[model samples]
Target: MDVALVLIGLVGGVITALSPCILPVLPVIFLSGADRERRPYPVVAGLVLSFSLLTLLGAALLAALPLPPGTIRWAGLVALVLLGIGLIVPRFEAILEAPFARLPQARAGRDRGGFVLGLVLGTVYVPCAGPVLAAITIAGATGDIGAGTIALTAGFAVGTGLTLMVFALAGRAVSQRVAAFRRRQRAIRVASGVAVVLLALGLTFGVNVPNYATALDHEFQRLLPAHVPTGSDVPPALAECVGQALYTEPPDESQDCGPAPALTGITDWVGTPVTLAGLRGKVVLVDFWTFDCINCRHVIPHVEDWYAKYHAQGLEVIGVHTPEYSFEHEIAGVRRAVAREGITYPVAVDNDYGTWQAYGVQAWPSLFLVDAMGQVRHVAVGEGGYDETENLIRELLTTP
Candidate 1:
């Protein structure tokens, strides 16, 4: 799954480079090779490194901090505008370069200068945020600074860098062959600079890039294979009968795990409560979910199906809605989301996390299968484990 996600990021980066918004900046790749005397690798390396680092940092900050969506967009736009001005007017470059004048001017000064220029261009040339990029950003926003996130970001940067390197090499060949290109280099720079400025303006003024990106992303997702597991293979223990040991190693019956915690601190209840003692004869599946969580949303259909299939057979599904964002705390928001998602099952809004902490929940979309005796018999986190979870549910439902 991580590999697939990384591949998606790589493909997304390639697609983004080919998009209309990025076309203007494609020409900027030639700048690295303009001075054939200096090697282009330093500039290329700088661009890739800067872009990747900045992307990771941006994602981390967005996830950790509650920043307005428009803030980053506006800042990027301003930076691009200033860069465009610097490119079109050589005089402006002097003003911009003043801050970095203290650096030593040795034999590698030109290479260092090229690197700095590439860094600036890389930072300013943000592609339209497509689904893959959005996923990476969301992971970052959710405080998931794991290897998967890093891999995705690195894959994207590499894809963009590979494309840019090709363009740079091709431009270098053209510059060497065509005297006209060399003679009119300034004109090309000004034209590309103007194009970048226009692109930035379009983003700042809302050109509906997100809508287009979403449509494109959906089309791409359709091409990929389904990653989630289905409950086609159920274990014999869960499939056969109730009152049977659900696991090879049974839980310590004498431990006295206590009655299931009351559904406390719930801001809204979608249906009647299914308390531990009240539902003693029935099996219960407690789901920790948030409306906005993608993983949680993915498992909803399966959960709903289980409720529909087994509700009449002494099976109960309870959703504990624990919010990750502040906006989700509002009862109206959760209600609207529930309606939008067509969730008919009973849902308890854990606004204060009373239930979350009681269960020692750590992630969204966690499931706990409680037997008819009101003891937690099974647990699963994140996505997948469909067969195991549903089997446990069946076993509990069948227990006398």
Candidate 2:
């Protein structure tokens, strides 16, 4: 269903929406009532709507604008640092004293002024929540279009609104339990401060970089043969080097396939072993994949079609699930991913990456073609090679 792009968008949205920065400021909206009389709904609604709309714009800009990939991350980081510095000195006196702090007072609880009110409040709220919002917007820029931006905006609004609703309804309940709220507030402030700093760190160091999937895709594209049977006439040294850098290693006759490592399963999840040895005498193809990787999802259809066509002719496909994220380690999540993807082949959980390391695989959706003798013959990392892979399978199955 072309879920990769959508999922990326959804995740980007949710990440920004659920940020700690947005959560704490929601109380301010209700508290601005001075004497606190049923905290006006329009104010809260307007704030969420405006923030969501702003994020949507940010996402659209990200999609339309031709900016460097990491620019958003850096911007988000800087914004966060500035936010943290402001929070450390929350007094207006300190801000007013600064040479550049000539910002005027924001009209506190006026929500009935229509679009201008929404725009003004949203703009003013930026100083309070800008760091996190910027980070989310920056993240949206990593995708192809407004998908990431819209998803993040929607997710943020939902998350923030959900919490605000709870707080709004239970404001009196919360007020009575001021001690608990204060404790929670303290924890929240600490978390917000930490999140901003972490964002800065991630931007500075390029953490969770988006190169893994694209890098693998490019690697696969490079291996396409110029002519059938006779691959590229490129020098062996360059090919070997490229292969080593992309995959785990190049096929070497003298190099042992190594002692087959003991496959480790995810904790608390028990599943039967689906190994190449179990399907011996059949043309076996093992796909080393992770659920979170975008490039891996792109080539699933080709693999599925190839497996269906060749299965009756002594062909066996096994999926080795080596997760890249902590959440992917969950057996239920893995099962869900497998089901949603409509994967019929036997899947082995390589949560510890034992199989990945054994085969020297470094990329998701890496394919290893094993001949009937269980010898590794062809390795394709990241997609393509449908015809080549099919021919190889047909050759192995038909040989004897």
Candidate 3:
């Protein structure tokens, strides 16, 4: 990887540590090395290893598997809750510690316990790394799993690990100097546990801490004279056909279901004004998306690829820019987003939700495939199902 990319990853990792997503986990780092009898290096090593592996594997799995992001998020939430409960209740901690006790290293000093705790922490800690991490994950999703990608991901993990170790070692020193602090460690643990539970509740209720952190980062950068790159310049069209399994399985043929909805109440059109009637003789793919949504952004590359690949083969791809947030309703904002995202297909601005209501669209990044006869053939919501949608399109084009 280039030095610039590595540096970006390192900086991104440090920013992630400072983000609110990592706030709850800070106590864990502090406590990991709070016991002077325990060595922090083992815990730090475990954290680095687990986090780096998970980051790399998770990105690849997201690209290769039809795993729902919601499912993963919920699972992580559950883990956090359990950890928080364990921290608060002594009996619960003993119960949770049983599994770790089975490890051979558990017989050693508290260092082994620290290592095991680090492993669990690594699995559950979901820090928001903003644009740099976004670019890396995008590259992974687009099948850019090269040495450079691995190096960048590793560099991010290293940065995080190093910062955590610093906190842990400092905690160890403080514990050694202050005998009273060591005596009151249990109370501190309980407080930390409560904080973690509150954080979990916040995340469950859709409090986007990462976005807030990103905004702070932006403001901080503005104060500096030198322009700081947030990795937003990463290409928007880097997606390739990683595999078909990332989405749902394809249908054998396009089913002539019902009439397609018309594009109505469009304030502006990006490429050309497209009507269902006008696209009767062509295979059409309608994509519903908003600019601010991460899920929508991730799906854009695949949508763009489909357009580039099949536009010449009688496939008409139209993006319906549906507004999720209030800012997305502004035409200038939507236009700038379109330009930044490299969306060149016909985009009908659904400012009034007229088109959205007509199509009965309920989610961002929804897709509907229409046959040559203006019949809705296939549909997908959220992310994935690229292969199935593409297959349906190909089937419709070949038919008649």
Q: By descending lDDT, how would the candidates be arranged?
A: 3, 1, 2
Q: Which ten residues in a row have the lowest lDDT in candidate 2?
A: 224-233
lDDT of each: 0.61, 0.48, 0.64
Please, what's the RMSD in Å of model 3?
15.7
| Model 2 quality (TM-score) | 0.41
TM-score of 3: 0.51
Best by TM-score: 3
User: Which residue pairs of candidate 3 clash?
Assistant: 247-385
Candidate 2, number of clashes: 3
Error of 3 at 232 (Å): 14
Model 3 residue 140 CA deviation in Å = 2.8
- What's the TM-score of each model vs. the native? 0.48, 0.41, 0.51
List CA RMSD, all candidates.
11.9, 17.5, 15.7
Candidate 1 lDDT, 1-400, residue by residue in tens = 3787577567767656655435546555665465454345665667778667656665456545676533454565676677668668868855766676777744344455556666655655555434355445445444546777787787788777777787778777887888876787777667656755775675444342211233343345445442211112323332221112111222323222335555666766876755667778788888888765555666788899998989999888889987654345667767776786778888898866667656645445667777788766666555555777777677667667
Q: Write the per-residue lDDT of candidate 3 for residues 1-400, one digit (tens) a residue.
A: 6665566567667766665656657676776577444477876777677666655665456446666433444565676677678668868866766776767774463566556656656655665534455445445443456766676677688777788888888888888789876788787667656765765676554343322354454443233222222123222211110111112343455544467767777888877787889888998888888765555666788889988988999998999987543335567767777888899888998766667656655345667788888867776655555777777777777889
Residue range 1-400, candidate 2, lDDT tens digits = 3343334333333332333333334344333222132233544566568656544454445446676422443444465455444433435213523542343424322223212222323432321122123334333332323444355455556655555545545654554467664545444444434544554554343232222233333443244321111113333432343254343333432211322223344333223556556666887777877654445666676788888988988888878887543335567767776776778887788755555545545345677777777766666665455676677777778877
